[model samples]
Target: MASLSFVNVCKTYKNGLTVVKDFNLDIKDREFLILVGPSGCGKSMTLRMIAGLEDITSGELWIDGQLMNMTSPQSRDLSMVFQSYALYPHLTVYQNMAFGLKVHKVPKDEIEKRVGRAAEILHISHLLDRKPSALSGGQKQRVAIGSVIVRQPKAYLMDEPLSNLDAKLRSQMRVELAKIHRELGATIIYVTHDQVEAMTLGTRIVVMNSGVIQQAASPNDIYENPVNKFVAGFIGSPSMNFFPVWVARRGEKICLEFGKNKLIANEICSKRLVEDGYVGRRVYLGIRPEDFHEEGPEEQKILFDVEMKEVLGAEILFHGRINREEICVRLSPNVKAEPGERLPVYVDMDRIKLFDMDTEQNIIYV
Candidate 1:
């Protein structure tokens, strides 16, 4: 296993296209770190740089205490699994898995032993005589990974390896991949645009946008304590609701205002607002869909009517408009709701997020 670090890393093409900007991350040994974002976010580029498939334009990449700027792919001590299986159709499972060892001129008996073990671990031992053309999509991916496993590299680099599989297979494989990692104790850096995969498989997630990292944290931390609006909106399903809010003092208590709605702030946030000098300033209020409720006992709660309700399996999403801003609440699917009804909303004052109006950066105390 190896620890990886990207220090002030950058990637710029010859056409003057800057894909990555001052990217930095320190991945620990045997850590399953996931890089996630939309396309063209430089996630794949970062992986390529680590794999020695692409040269860095600037900065440094260190693996296991060694700088890997000019090292070739073979010397990087890494195995990569691509979106496409990249398997040799003509070669049987054993031959395909053993090919790398053969090229390195490992003894025939040793190659057979390694390949056999990999196939067994992957549960493809019975398919050793079968070619890629005869295997299922998930099976092909397993064979591809088995090929990598036989190499016994220091790390595994996976780039959207499940994109081609059906939903059910992908889900199954995600769990299997986690198990395989534990079994091998290998460091893995997986790149995917799928948030579900990123959330479920990673020990830590690094979310990138436009070649810049937006946030890096554990799944729960990333969801609950996003640093800014972008991270807050991007990390969750149904996303968080944002609206303009004005900070002020109402009578003896501190409060925030949104159009006709006004709610006294909790002690924790009131203290923070005063400390951050946000009193009497226009800011943004962020609340997640799941955080919204009908009503709760607190100093105050902002209520809004339901304009629409969507039943999605275990949760019902309430769509309501506040000051021309559309907001939603995820509640129990068992709740009875309807359109055109003014629903009383129970805002969780303690769970609310505050952001600076100017920079759109979260102002909540970390």
Candidate 2:
């Protein structure tokens, strides 16, 4: 296994359009790191740069201990699994898995041993003789991964390898991929647009937007303590509810006022806001869908007319509007509520997030 580093790396076109800017990261050996963001966010480009498939306009790329800014793709000693799977339709799974080694003149017996081990690890040992044309989407994906595993590269680069699979298959593949990582103890750098994949498979995730990294941290930190509004809103499924609230002081306590409703701020939040001189300023109040409670005293409640309800088996998502801004609340599936019905919702004040109205940066952490 080998560690990788990107030091002030950048990519720019001749037209002066920069797709990646001053990107820097250190990936530990045997770590599963995921780079995630929306489309056109430069994640794929960054992966390609690491693989030597894209040129770094500036800065250095290092693998293990050596600088590899000018290294060729085949000389990088890394394996990349593309979104397309890139399987050879004319070759059987066994031949496809053996192709890389065969080109390097690995002994026939050694080649068979490596391929067999990889196939067993991926649970595709029985499909070795079948051609790509005869394989299912999930099966073909495994074969692609198996081919890379046989080479025993220093690190694995996966670019949305499960994007083509159906939703159910993608979920199953995520589990399988996690198991594969454990079995091999390999260093992997995976890029994807799926937050679920990032949250579930990554030991650490890098969230990117517009060629800049929004945050790089463990899944829990990224979800619960996002550095900015973009990171908080991007990492969660239902996103976060942002309300334009007024900060006010009442006696020794601070409160956030939303329309006619008021939520008492916690001690920490109050101190920070008072010290920052935001007692009468407007800020964005962020609350996750799951943080809204239905069981609270009337004084703590904020009434909303339910606009819609989505039944998602274990939970019911109630969609509503507050001052023309949309908000969603995730409740127990057994909770009875319907559209056009009025519901009183309370927020977990301690779990709420506060962001600067002008900068959109988390003020609580600042």
Best by lDDT: 2
lDDT of 2 by residue, 1-366 (tens): 999999999999999999999998999999999999999999999999989999999999999999999999889888989899999999999999999899878999999999999899889999999999999999999999999989888999999999999999999999989998998999999999999999999999999999998899999999999998899899999999899999998887898988878889988899889988889999999999999887976655787779999999999999998767789999988789889988888888889999998889898873
**TM-scores of the candidates in the order shown:** 0.94, 0.98
- Per-residue error for 341 in candidate 2, Å, reads 1.6
Looking at model 1, residue 308 earns an lDDT score of: 86
How do the residues 272-345 of candidate 1 rate in per-residue lDDT, one tens digit apiece?
88889999999999988888776676545666778888888988898988878999988887677788777666
> After superposing candidate 1, which stretches have Cα over 4 Å from the reference?
298-300, 305-307
Off by over 4 Å in 2: none
Per-model CA lDDT versus the true structure: 0.89, 0.92
Compared with the true structure, model 2 gives a TM-score of 0.98
